[model samples]
Target: MAIAWSGSLDFTVERSGKSLMGSAVSGEGLVNVYQGSGKVLLAPVG
Candidate 1:
């Protein structure tokens, strides 16, 4: 069998059986992914 990421691609962990809320992008090339504990990321992808 092939393995998959098969997981939530959010920046946080939430109830409702672990759900993702929303995402945002700023002019400074910052993306904020919200779920439980929100995250801020830069365009300088790692």
Candidate 2:
């Protein structure tokens, strides 16, 4: 099953030698994720 979440996150995904690497942050000034499996991250738009 897929979970849904909403919040503000600063994430960056990039390719590193044929691999993908990135960082994501949540709960920063109304940034939160709900109903997510933790691995899944969702951000809100205004």
Return the TM-score for each candidate structure.
0.17, 0.18
Which runs of model 2 end up more than 4 angstroms from their true locations? 1-5, 18-46
Q: Which model scores highest in TM-score?
A: 2
* Local lDDT at 5 for model 1: 28
Worst 10 residues of 1 by lDDT: 18-27
How much is the lDDT of residue 18 in candidate 1? 26
**Residue 9 in model 2: lDDT:** 34
Per residue, candidate 2 scores C-alpha lDDT tens digits across 1-46 of 2234334433333333332222223222222323423355346665
lDDT of 1: 0.33
Q: Which pairs clash (backbone N, Cα, C closer than 3 Å) in model 1? A: none
